[model samples]
Target: MERSNNTAVTYDSDMQSADLDHLELDSAQKKIGLLRLILCSAIGIFVFFVSVPHNGDTEIVFSIIYNKLVGLMGNFAYWVLVLIIAANFVCHLYYKYIKKGSCQSAFAKVYDNDSVLHTLLYALGLVYVVLYAMKVNIPGFEGPEIIVGAATGESVMPSIVLGVLGIIIVGALFMPFLLNYGILEIIGALLEPLMRPLFKVPGKAALDAVASFVSSSSLGVLITNRLWRKNVYTEKEMVSIMTGFSAVSIGFAYLVINTAGLGHQFVKVYGISFVLVFIMEMIMVRIWPIKKKKNVFYNGHEQTEAERREDTKMSLSLIPKGCTRAVKRAYIAKGVPSEVIASLKDSFLILPQVLTMLSAIGVSGLILANYTPIFKWIGYIFQPLLILFRVPDVAAIAPSLPVGIAEMFLPVLLISGNIGAISVKARAFVTIVSMVQIIFFSETATVMLATKSPIKFREIVICFLERTIIAIPLAAAVIHLFF
Candidate 1:
């Protein structure tokens, strides 16, 4: 309802620290990263030789990833063993030499309690493998453990390795698209032209287009917010622009949804989201046409240039690495007592959080797989829903919304397998919905925080309904034409 709009990836891990500047010491997150690296890397390798194809129809491309991890980890069996030492090395460096609130933000935040590495690694979803491998099941989310049990078949190593491959391959495939390119090209060109026509906002199209590429929606939103404040866009423009722009959060739509059995819907979900946004923006432009008022022109949604500048300056100052830290440290370092810095260990919590996430994902995957029949049955009832989207009756499988309850990346997993199960038409339906923005809690939070806007819980619900309404037909078309 407020000014809506959209950037590139900042680490999902770094999000927890948005409000933690008050804390002095860097985080104490360890072990969890190590375990994550091991389980996922190993599982990734397993995916290569076993479930994946030999390039025939290429149902899944397994070995392509397993070999890569073997190279990165040196040995699949101890991927975490190596990753741990590496993570500790970085943490120790931060603990020793780095002085927060005293130096450049990009370089300084590295040592600050919330290191950028945490964000990147956490985004990878490896932590899920470790917790499940250790049989740690989150009380409410028992699904992941069950998935691990099923994935590894009798051996956790096989399942863990397959999972490992899944996480890494997914991470690598779109890393650049997820991160910023500074010169946005392919995707940028594709989505940018719509800005002036749809939202009437203007600036770098590619920069904001990162939202479409990766799972971490927050990163893209932050970038857009910064641009908006720079006066790159008008307030109404920002809102209207994002009408089509704020499809699904890439993280949830890609990483989480696909992980559940509905992984195949990636293209379908994303395609629908894109088409809907484009349509909405065009409609808004036609209806309002950016009309001018008799006196000082304004829409209920517009932010004054001065207000825009002020917000932009504050956000830029806060987000960047150098000045913000200098200012914060100047105040804290002067008289806060050096002893407080020494006791800062209590504040860092990435290791535990990672552990929680990893356990939840693994258990959730296991449970879902164990109850595959239940899902199939659910698919039968949902066949009507698929029918609405023009999904073929023979190609039905319930959408993969369950993995979110336990693991974040489970959505990606679901897309990989079941999408191929249905007719190409059904597959297309699944792919588009899977990619449409929204659904994932992580994605929802990213949009809310980055824009500093008030998007209600119900707003997301409405967004989903609108997107789904538009997507069903598009998916059907893809199936009818291609498959």
Candidate 2:
């Protein structure tokens, strides 16, 4: 009996020891897994954000690939893009507006206004199809010619198409890595304190702003919408980022500079615009209309767990924890192919809206600038302001200021040769202002109106006016200081 009791005790001790060893091994394995995720994620974030030379110019990897694809495909690529956009417009109009097709009943009921708007866009697309693709000229339609030429022309349309393509590729191939792998979470944690206090937005917004700067403003808005949908941002926060921080892409800035005859002074032009736009953003976020927006997150989840981390503390483990979270996210996220398709779907949904609305608004804005005295009357409001800055040719320059609403590029185009009349300082002033205007019907405005964000069309116009009112003087001050 004594020997039996002793044997039982020994068995229990061995079992407990084995269990503890197994637990330790499992814990070590998890740590190893987390470290691996952190390393892989860090590599991905670096590649996407870092710019390198591709064909003798520096840009991000995605831009290099997009430019190559554009070079390889050439005009055929634009034709394909335009056709795809037109087809989507027609289908959306027919299924959602004309027939109210039950196949898409769920989507239709939710986006009735979108369907109605798309129907009108379909008509505009048809006009452009006739004008650009078919080369058919209609009498009394001279107003649309410039827009047609601009949209389908060698430079503008190609750039727009390439931008979308880059989004499709990058969003598909890389976005999943960043979003799923906790790269955004890590960056958000690091930047959250700065972003939230200063911008009243989550640190995740830093990604949107960077994406927009590197890719396109349209891409930035798309990202903002995604963040909003995912419960990461409130409607107000998304709108603020979309409108304020989502400036034109670096590529577009380069185009703007080259077009404005400031290519030789590219560094100065871009640097000044960048500084003034940020300054304007700081002021705009605290002002009315924007400040009035309700700061409510999607699904009412205001404080995410990651966000609750005491931002004041810094630890080496934060990065690994971020990566571990990213790994879990990436695992939950759909595969690369699905993500790419989703990206393409987003592009399709937005392109028709951009093409249609840009056509109508751009044409009208151009017409008003060219044929009427409307802008001239509006120009008077800025005349005194421009004169205050000592910008020469105030009459000619003031009219161009209001035309930026039609398209940011219009102001530059309107003032093209006439810029010689103004001092180089004033030329710098106008160049920076046009880029900072932020409200242009051609791309950004169209996308804003198409979005489900609560910002109304009137508010967008008001914001544009507000941006101009603030940007002009600030730009003038910077130009005078530098030039």
Candidate 3:
């Protein structure tokens, strides 16, 4: 989720006798809070019992386990089934601790109020329950086509696994900010000067680059957001900096790409494309040259009342101190209430745009499904572009188009379709494209949120179009010339 411009506020209707605004939990909850640690340890033990083959791909193990089970207990679904069991256990403990003792965290306070994490966990677990309950017949998942391969642990185990994974992921994502204030202070000091000359923008720091490359994009955006709020940057500079890092989260770049179905080539193309995009925007900033009419312009004339209150709470005393304070500040600024608002907005606002994108791609895919015609089309598209780089038509479409989304399983798809056996060139194309991004949709929310620029359909389309114009052909050449 994007960081909110507004400060994080946890409304506390459950105030105590002393009536401190910060509504801490009682002594019992604090003492029993150790249960979360216990649950995590339990999950760790369960993971060991399962003997999960954490081979880069668990398909063989998962599929074989799927074949052996006669009932849900012995079934592959049981692992995920455990998620629901574990979640319930954890939730009970969470509630018990809060009621019994002091709840220290504002995150814990807000978790009590908004129930955002609970909703996601419940929604995810319920998906498994509903799917298995319907238990009709399909080959692998035992569901209808619409719900095909719908990540059935169709058991609670998947849910539990996700819950654990969620804990890991949230910690990883949240930690840098929790721990990196010293780095930021150092970065803001050291990198600001060098940043200007390298990017030709007045001042967005190396911190932006470090954050984008090493951690989450939301964090990099947060840093930029802070600078903007403090009036350290002009309006156009904000746009340039935001665009320079339109992609977010090293998680997708590293974990999902390298560790998942897509392999090394995917990583290379995506890394290169993003690097190019960053470079191009930096170059483009020099070309467009932000003409500032005023000394500065923000989304408004002044920081709003909400912003003022949150800032005061953060700097003065609303936040608790420790290894977690900066994260709490940033997170609270983009807290539960605001997350609810943004998620709702994205669900509604992004629908039509998603439908439009899907529709256009669907039509094109139908025509391009024929290999003979598709190759001809690719030749026509890339021949002229290839001339600019002194290369022949690479005939490799993977790097050139937004195929990441379509061909995530291109290796499997090609193996099934007999495409791999037919031609070396086609195999190369599939490999390269699969290695790159999975189009922008799977990543739509992140991509849209990464930018401070207005993330409307038209603007996104325009930015994507700019990349498509060059990215694909460059990829084709790389594939042809190298692998």
Candidate 4:
């Protein structure tokens, strides 16, 4: 009898000790998470947003680092890009042909899923890099000046491609600091009221916007698509968020502003563009196409009015609620090192494919802009609007505006040489319009189509035109008012 009593007491004591250990561990994890959330978020902000003087110019730390890296590499950067494209081509070939698309590895899956068109684009990218690097001109094709010269190849390889590669690599490496931590959770929780009503999306979508803002638009689309598949959002919510919220990153904004020769006005250009994107999105969600999308979940069931009403209800005690959610998220976050590695791995898997697309589409768009009259004719459509807005140098900046549909940076590339002809406000106006017109085919559009989001190609095209039309006057007004 005494032995049984002692055994019961011992078991109870053991349970108490284990409970105490669990409580202490939970408390410790919360502390670590809070620290990580604060410190890592600060680091991310400093890297991406804080501007400092470097080499006679004030630039964001991200750009400064990019410049230094470019300077360090010198002419060798061209070969590095070529090698990346080459690797992309070779991997796709292996995955699709040799492996017969049977590989299940993440990298293999990404490469193997490429359509024939994407593979061909990768091949074209390879050819472009080789031609540009060797400065070789094909006899039957356009001359070196057009094919490999300053207007097309030179503009693309050295400027856009390299910038993208550097940004993706560095940005991906540092992205976990912003995303995996608890800052976004806090922001999401606090902004739920405003986002739900204004954007008709859950507050969690704010994270997608910030992710796109600090990182890239494709990342934002990926996040939105994933959420939709998980039934966290309905089809209407997904389409609205994907089309409206996937904005250009700040890093890319810097590239555009610099390309437009308005690098000195980085703060003003980005600030105005950032505000204009949200304004455009707010108006876009209320219009056709997006507004017309059915409110069905991924599995095809319609979202009930009751469910939507629950989602739209605004909490009265937002601060406390936000903090509670943030603390829970922080408490559950993985270690920083693991999060960063995972982020970089994801970035690298997509990097090869994205860079290849950039090289292929960026060069193709620039070629069309430089050598053909198509964009020029398209420019005439917007000439009246430019006139109505009283924007200077309409003829020069007009062609640039429509070219943004091909690739956002093409407009900047087209007008970059006309520094003397185009006025500063005109250049800034074009820059903002290109960014706010977010349906460029090179990256964002391609990624969107790749997802199973039920968005048609025709819808994407119409949205592009609509956003372009809306953005032009709004951008022009802001430029004229502020600059």
Candidate 5:
């Protein structure tokens, strides 16, 4: 009997030791994760948010790296892009014909999942790049002077296509540090109170807005779409965030201001634009399309009332709670190298499709704005508002307002000649309007469409028009008040 009791005690002691070891291991892992989260999130904040002087320009570290790469590559960068497009074309052909759509490779899946129209666009993009790189105009297929102009090609290739490629690659490589390392959880927890009441979105969405302001609008959409896929946001929230908050980066805002000849008033104009954009977002989230979207997640998960309350429960210890969440998330996240590789793969998979869409749709829009009367006719709709605001050069500037839908920069280009003649107030108004009316076919719109988010092209157009209409009066008021 005594022997039996001793054996049982020995077993109990062994079980207790095992439990203690497991507790020790888990505690160690949590500590390691906390350290990782702090280090990685710090890197992300510095890279995306902190602006430093580089080659006489104050810009973020990401922009510095991108500009340096562009400078080093010079004309060679165009050729590299051509090679990437050509490779995508071959892969598409192989996926369609050789493999008969049976291949399950990630590259094949992404490149082959295009409609016939998109396939044609991809082909056209290849031709466009080849012609531009080789400086050869096709004999029988020469379209218009503007369509075939060296200036036009330069604008599309370097300004749009190369910019997208560079930003996506660089942004993707560094984004894991921000996204996979638990910064969102910490920020989301802290901002939930304000975000829920003002924007009707979770606080994590604040990070998306910051990402767009600091990096590129496309990166913001990418982050939002990724979160949606993971069921972090519902469909309604995704659409609202994409349409409402995915603003252009500050650097691009400066470019728009500079282009409008309002470089002197950049600080003032951008400051007003910053406030106006949020106003538009607050209103936009409560209107059509966005307000009408379903609240179900991307994977069809619905949050019960109980779950929602628990997820959003506020407490006095928010700082500690946020830190705990961050550490827990970090503990489960993939290693830095693995996360980065995965992010790069995601970027590459979408690169071909996005670039092709930008080339085809962007060029078409530019041509329409530069050569056609479609936008001019549309501009007449805004004539009443422009005239009501007592805006100068009403006839000339009205068209620039609506042309922003085609390309954000086209508005400034259309009015460039009048920049010297227009009032500072007028120039500031146009610059602010262009920046606030964020949906443009050339970039942000194309990037949004390329994502798996459920935003239709029609919806994007409606959102653009809505934003323009809403922004005009508000922008005019601010410009008139300040100027």
Candidate 6:
């Protein structure tokens, strides 16, 4: 009996061990599956969004696809964007004025302060839709086609749609891989010392700068807002990044250069742009308003610096250290699909706001520039500065300078129209200054205001002036030296 009992016990123990091994195997397979999904998705996003070596001119893979879709869909794609913006208008109107108990909901509270202005803006958006989409002509209020053109144009809407979609695909989908795999942390670790010392910000800020340069500045602010919400960045740091470092992307830089008839001067102009922006960033963060910003994280937590390399022997090898950190991060990252869905939801919520604000400010500002002398009135402030720099056609150039505050591309458009009036050096100066100015209501400023970050309109306006002031002479010097 004892011998029989021992045999049964040993068999049971063996079966239990086999089950444990099988369970581990199953877990390992799941992890591998997830890792593959993340890596493949990341590679696909990078190939599509990031520029690659292509015949002479750089083109993003998705832009080619988007242009084709727009061509195929024709006016349908254009109307679709208009309708989407109109829908946003309707929803905001319902929440602010029509819906039952709308005020009780969190959504309504967001527009409580500016519901009237927003309603008027949305109404104007719908009008512009009619003006541009249907080609409706109204007497006396003869449209400033250039101003409303941006709101209802093929270029801007397609860019906005594709940008949001890119955020969903690249940011939502691939971010886990980038974050989990230790790309960000390792980058943070490598650059922290320099970033913190110069900008008074953490090394992770390098990612924001790169994202802004490669992607859009608005997207950079979105990432900064994300980090701020996650308590990775404090208010001061987030504000510093959003206002100072988030210049237009390389792609947009190319657009401004091409539009301003400075494609020949691309290399020098582009280099001067980003370098001058960085130098001004260091100055901006150390000055007023930005300097007075509260240094507390979103959740009231203090951001502690990453531990020094001396704390761990693995830190001796940068690659191994980064890989180890990435592995740990990837292990804890949220599931891919859920994260992507969350990103999509966030984009949808922000779409109407972006369209409304961008449309309102873009149209009105363009009107002021075209029909009124407000830009000229504002031009006086920049007149002396332009004169000091010896920019040709100072009166013409002065008005163009402040118009960029409305839209970055506006300055380029103005320069392009009057290309014969300004020297090559002045053109180069305008191109770099417009890009580095960075605070345009049509996109960057509007997006920054939408974020929960500590930036205010007053502050943004101040930063715009400061950047323009700082960038001008530096850009002029570069133009004199190189152009």
Specify the highest-TM-score model's number: 5
lDDT of each: 0.38, 0.64, 0.37, 0.74, 0.78, 0.65
lDDT of 3 by residue, 1-483 (tens): 222224543432111111222333334433332232233323322321223444463422212232233233343433343343345435434654445335645323323432443344344334534454345333354654223233212211232222222322232333333222222322233343445545644322554545544444433444454455435444555555654553434433544344333455666645654555554565545533322222243534432334222222213232222212222222222333443354334332322222222222322232233233453444455446645544432343323343333223322343334443334433443343333332243233222332223334454444444544544455556656655
Measured on C-alpha atoms, candidate 1 has an lDDT of 0.38
Cα lDDT of model 1 by residue, 204-322, tens digit:
44445544343233333434443344334444454433434544344345544444444566665555555655554454444432232111112233444443232122223333432
Candidate 4 has a TM-score of 0.76
The number of the candidate with the highest lDDT is 5
How many pairs of residues collide in each model?
Answer: 74, 3, 32, 0, 0, 3
TM-score ranking from best candidate downward: 5, 2, 6, 4, 3, 1
Deviation from native of the Cα of residue 299 in model 6, angstroms = 2.5
**TM-score of structure candidate 5:** 0.88
Residue runs of model 2 more than 4 Å from their true location after superposition: 1-47, 98-111, 115-117, 136-144, 150-156, 300-338, 341-351, 358-373
Better of 3 and 4 by TM-score: 4
The RMSD of every model to the true structure, in order and in angstroms, is 16.1, 8.8, 14.3, 7.5, 6.9, 8.6
Tens-place lDDT digits, model 2, residues 18-50: 122222213443554355457646655665567
Roughly what TM-score does model 2 have, to 2 decimal places? 0.80
lDDT of 4: 0.74
Off by over 4 Å in 6: 1-49, 52-57, 62-73, 98-114, 136-181, 304-321, 389-393
Number of colliding residue pairs in model 1: 74
Among all windows of 10 consecutive residues in model 3, the one with the lowest summed lDDT is 12-21
TM-score for each predicted model, relative to the true structure: 0.40, 0.80, 0.43, 0.76, 0.88, 0.80
For 1-483, candidate 4 gives per-residue lDDT tens digits of: 011211322222112111222222246656765676678878877876677887786767766776577768877777888888899899889998889878899788876556788778888888888778666333354436766778778877776577767766676677666655556556665676788788887777887787678756876776676567646578888988888888988868898899899899999889988888888888888998998988998877787766554424467666665555454444455667777787677767777777777778767867887799999899999999999989888888898888887778888888888788788888888888998898876667755764446687689888999999999889879888988
Instruction: Name the 10 consecutive residues with the lowest summed lDDT in model 5.
Output: 9-18
lDDT of 1 at 157: 33
TM-score between model 6 and native? 0.80
The CA lDDT at 199 in model 3 is: 61
